[model samples]
Target: MADDLRVDRMTEKQAREELARLAELLGEANAAYHRDDAPVMSDAEYDRLRQRNAAIEAAFPALKRADSPSEQVGAAPAEGFGKISHSERMLSLGNAFEADEVREFDARVRRYLNLGPDAALDYTAEPKIDGLSLSLRYEEGRFVQAATRGDGQVGENVTANARTIGDIPDRIEGAPDILEVRGEVYMSHADFEALNARQAERGDKTFANPRNAAAGSLRQLDAEITRARPLRFFAYAWGALSEPLAETQMGAIERLSELGFVTNDLTRLCDGAEEMLAHYETIEQMRATLGYDIDGVVYKVNALALQARLGYRSTTPRWAIAHKFPAELAWTRLEAIDIQVGRTGALSPVARLSPVTVGGVVVSNATLHNEDYIAGRAASGEAIRGGKDIRVGDWVQVYRAGDVIPKIADVDLERRPEDAEPYRFPETCPECGSEAVREEGDAVRRCTGGLICPAQAVEKLRHFVSRAAFDIEGLGAKQVEQFFADGWIAEPADIFTLESRFGSGMKQLKNREGWGEKSAENLFAAIEARREVALSRLLYSLGIRHLGEVAAQDLARHYQSWEALVEAVDLARPAAQAHRAGEEAAEAERAAAAAEGRGARVSEARARARSERDVPEDAQAAWDDLVAVDGIGPVLALSLSEALANPEERAAIDRLVGKLARIVPPEARAEDSPVAGKTVVFTGTLEKMTRDEAKARAEALGAKVSGSVSSKTDLVVAGPGAGSKAKKARDLGIEMIDEDAWLALIGDA
Candidate 1:
């Protein structure tokens, strides 16, 4: 322990400099890993540096800082993500890179919890998928939004794309109104290959691996694109919730799964180190077949109550450890080639590699990507660039990419027989007899079959009722696919249209071979419940290109009527002609004078107009007027008016809204309001307040009340000992004002 840490004895100046350097290094590594699943440093190298930094902070406890590199997680949330004050701060976990470290971590957890000598501290272990972490927000029984873990304080909104995943339920059954579930959005090896295959066909660039594919897809500028990708999510832990959940980690996971969130079935609860290690072994063994990429297994204290009691050390929870898997290599033969059609109508080819083992998991197949990829492979499945063609009966080298997928590395040309020939790909769809056409500048081929392909149809149906989309329960991806395969379902409306042979559509639904009465009833109820959703959701569910949650929201607020929205969607006139046809400020002013018999400022005329383009002369006046609102901007205004100009969009919106519920925000959106810029830290007891009250007050006052005090904190309101928070504020030279001071500053009320 002594040698592992050696920094306390240093001068404060040296400590500060060391801390700064550590911050930079960790920040870069975190960004590289989170923003791009590409780690800048080896796990060991990162662990060594982290340990050194922790030691330094421990040695010089007085020099310890709140925003120190050792305490921070990733880079401060990137701008643009909605900032959320976690009910419980989102902390980083302690990493154990070796068996010894794992043992030490085990020791520490027991020591902190005061466990008996023979006490069994079983841990639940799961493969930690190497992907971006996200916080999913559910309000009033609906999946409302999702955000990235920006800086523990803020997160970027990726809710639009998150809506696409079928595993994530938009509305969970038997859950509190407000829930903040945490999960990892990842791509399976199969899905990743299929995605890249499609990309290749389109001549678009491909990601290096599944992790990159998952990260890049989720972070897309357009949520519609994200919706198109076959990303998956598995909820592990949680952040803030309107209410408390089960007492144990496994219990929480079980509860999540029951509530409709997808959970990793591989998770296990071990009773001790031996059992934990065994569980880890089991997980490592299933790595390749697991589909998604997992760099390591995470062992966390099972009991939620126990976890809270163990508390945290600095920024990391003391009750968890990440045990990584060792990397390995093997070789397999290339066999049949198959193409799978996706819900988005994209076609992909999969290589059936002969069986082998990598990192304990058996590898049976790898993604060949596209025609270009196949042409680049040797007859022995090795790269033929200046090299051979990938053919049947050829042995190909396979290696672990993050210890999850068995990726093709090269081919064993020396072992190849003269009988192997180039594997021929199909020129038409395997599922539907549609001509597979390769669009110009594409690497992948498309089954031009559209809605006729069974695979695509089922996939699309599953997407329609996905947790992130309409969140229609009872009709899950599997059930939808099943019904589609059974010929009981077809279009999106067929799900609702399926009549029950029995009573209330339940008995009949239940009378069906696969569905029980209760299950059928429950599903019918859920589907019926969603018959009327919000205009934005209905628009998004239509699966239109270049249209997403944000755009839908904007359109919804812009028109406020379905008739208006559909009218805009169908606009056929050229934008330039419409732009010139709209009313101008000058004409509006003259009209106002003529109409009222007395003319005022151009502002007066503009104020009377609902939109700038309402008048035929000088529309800029009204445009400027709309831009004056807090949330409305020039870009949004232009898009709203231009889109509204189309009659088709407006008409569709009208019809859709007729059957949907109005979405009213909790409150009006706040822009450059009072709470926008300031950081406030509340501490200790308040004579007339609760923690929630204080937080609300600060937020209402246009201030960000952070969980911890740091140099960034502008005001620290202390009531009593305030302990670490107050002291940290003082040490950092931040202003320390008492409760009364805060009240006086905000207002007497």
Candidate 2:
């Protein structure tokens, strides 16, 4: 009755019943492990079930289904990617859990290939990455489309985002006529942790593990967001081939590697099952220290001839086997949701859960990401979710790994008490009492208090200190948030005044988390050191709406002096008034039309003229001029003119001008600067600094920045995001440089 026990020879009907039972159990177990990363039974139990399935299949050859579990090697596809047609359908591999199974597999393969007992057969071994599966399709040598494995028959189209990944070659050198490569999309451990950290910082949901993280990232509807996530892919198989390659498996893999695909470096050729077992054992022992996610090692026949002869079962082939590793997740309860404010004004809701241990780490809170997600949970009729208002007493399932924030997997309907009602969200900002409002097109709600809101103030200050911004050596987001929470820092100006708070007690600031004595001093030093920043950076640090570094530069260049810019903004009032007068005149015309029927065109035109005659002559003149600036249309002119009409803003601008230096014309405009009239592209890692900073500098110096590297690119600053750009640049024989080299050329160092 043991599951692993070999089957007794029987009638085909009896064998079919065993096959049905075995397939059901095996499929469910595999789904549990593959989709959820949760296994209901031990590996031994699974092996036993699988052996029963194989025994049944062996006895009843004609009774198998095309998609039977025994024939499923590793995984099927998921929805949300483009469906790719593989020239050679990518087949799954059959598995062998024990030494006996491996021997039987070898024997069957040898027999099919007509090999005698003395004949030799070889195999290859490679560690299987735990991640989302995808197929890359190329036609006529250009990198074009990539699709996720959605039920094997179809997938989601992610070509745009897939194009952004630098590791995936846009074009292989001396490319083939048609190439379709299969691989696993995974996140490196470092990237996974970093991704979680970023999500936590933004008050958004974090992925439970690297596999889910990679899958979720690829499935995103917004390609830009996916492009931002740290995802990597490694090719393990070939589906469609344009031409034939070396006669052996090792040779095909070598050829793939040479063709610019990231083939697994661990692939090894073995003479028999003994060597394959030895290699798998070695990989199993070394699994802990690998920087990336790995589930198991795959073993495949080294020679294509042997594999073809061995043949296939409905879903899987006789060539390969997946030896799975262990699981890495823990479950806990959801208690409450707390809102977090990110530097960019994104509001994130976090799930406060009971503590859980995953991958040796204790976790209690998971990010809900945004209000939309929380609301979606409520709509799902989850008892703990309070139907839309998560209350204090509800129990919810929290999933975690090494991720800083866990994910709410389920709500405990049985644990919902009678007193618990749906939680209510505050309409006002919790910190500053500003109206909490959700904008028409935004996913997150916000406190419109701007500089007055404690959360936004800290977030903005932290953003100013970010590496791409001012790169303040000591100030981090946590430190900024703590300072804002403690009332020690209310604005960017307060960062310069932290010394005043120190007299009260430096201990409070130091122990506030993400803050320390050395860090605080370094932060102050950084603030002081930035006193001489270019006008553009100082403008960006202000965190003003519609005002980025480029805009600031444009403003600075146009006005020449900060004081003049303020005066121009003040003088711009006349133009706004003029513009408003025109609008008023238009409105009056419409209103006058109601005075008479539509038949009197001349009368209506006269009435409109009369309405404008009443508008103040000077106001009409000012509004007209405001509408003339390039890119400054009627609406933009009115908005700028109205906002600047405030006496307080005028005063603040006056005060700000006194504390800053004027950027000389040479530095202000890019007209004749270093890169002016030149086309420069940024790719990969810049040795001098971040790509953003480098791009900004280059742009300021008059260079045009393009996303792609082309024949016309004057220079290519190759860095880490340098995927296709590097290849294209190299192919076109364009000049490339590292960050340091760029800085040296620009004389920035």
Q: What is the C-alpha local distance difference test score of each model?
A: 0.68, 0.65
TM-score of each predicted structure versus truth: 0.44, 0.44
How far does residue 414 in candidate 1 sit from its true spot (Å)? 25
Give me the runs in candidate 2 sitting further than 4 Å from their true place: 1-427, 430-433, 437-446, 467-471, 500-521, 574-679, 686-697, 706-715, 719-721, 728-749
Could you give candidate 1's per-residue lDDT for residues 636-732 as a string of tens digits?
Answer: 4454565445465445434444544454322232445544568988888888788768875565455666888877888888997475577577668
Candidate 1 runs further than 4 Å off:
1-20, 35-45, 55-67, 327-749
lDDT of 1: 0.68
